[model samples]
Target: MAYMSGNPSNVSFVGAFLNTLGDRLFSAFNVAVEANGRMARVEALQALSDEQLAAKGLRREDIARHVFSDIFDV
Candidate 1:
């Protein structure tokens, strides 16, 4: 008669699953932070007086567009 031993470790996929989850969570956090920062900039610009805005070469109507100028051409 021969005796057989089963596999010792069973949770083989757990590490990979945790790593992927961590990466996704980190990416989401970064996106939220970036959007928050941009919105803050937009709000700051909106609070400025027309003269103050013109001093910075930005217009009230173009607040969002100006804040995102680096990412957009408008």
Candidate 2:
């Protein structure tokens, strides 16, 4: 009997692993961007005065909640 060496199972395993790894990498990338964006929003809001906040319809009390929403709404 001759030896046969091609394995479809190995190909499928490798493809699945690559796909999972790609998804994890993409998720991590998105999380990092979201965190950075939230930080920027917080900074921007903190830089504004109480009068400026009222003018823009954003209360000082809602800064944290609104900044988090602005980043994660995507």
Candidate 3:
């Protein structure tokens, strides 16, 4: 009689489960870091006075546009 080897189905299920879990965790982490960085930028800009903003050739009205523009634009 031939002996049965490990179950390939179970192996595939475990691999898929781990891959999905890792993807979710990584996505959550990326979102959190992006939010934190955006908040930091807002805080830094808020801390600047009108004169300081002017010296940098920026205005308060331009803050959002400046922060959210594409990386290639910057």
Candidate 4:
């Protein structure tokens, strides 16, 4: 029934709270990077001409669908 700040057995509520906040921030950062990458893909696809798009079996309207195909059934 003893508590010490430096003791490994004693975990502070503040420390746990900060760790949870850090985890959420890191997760949000990762999601942002992923979204930016997807945006880059969209831009790259948009730069392609109709002929180029057809070569890949995609149309200009299908860019977003192609980019997020793995995540959505659309």
Model 1 bad stretches (over 4 Å): 1-12, 72-74
- Where does candidate 4 stray beyond 4 Å? 1-11
Better of 1 and 2 by TM-score: 2
Worst 10 residues of 2 by lDDT: 65-74
lDDT of 1: 0.87
Q: What is the C-alpha RMSD of each candidate to the true structure, in Å?
A: 4.8, 3.7, 3.7, 3.9
Compute the lDDT of residue 58 as modeled in candidate 4. 97
Task: List clashing residue pairs in candidate 3.
Answer: none
lDDT over C-alpha atoms for residue 52 of model 2: 95
- Say which candidate scores most in TM-score: 4
lDDT of 2 by residue, 7-74 (tens): 98998899999999999999999999988988898899989999999998999888887877754563
User: On TM-score, who's better, 2 or 3?
Assistant: 2
Q: By TM-score, how accurate is candidate 1?
A: 0.71
TM-score of each: 0.71, 0.74, 0.68, 0.77
Which scores higher on TM-score, 3 or 4? 4
The 0-to-1 C-alpha lDDT of every candidate, in the order given, reads 0.87, 0.88, 0.85, 0.92
Clashing residue pairs found in predicted model 2: none
Question: Which candidate achieves the best lDDT against the true structure?
Answer: 4
Worst 10 residues of 1 by lDDT: 3-12
Candidate 4 to truth, TM: 0.77
List the lowest-lDDT window of 10 residues for candidate 3: 65-74
What is residue 68's positional error in candidate 3, in angstroms?
2.1
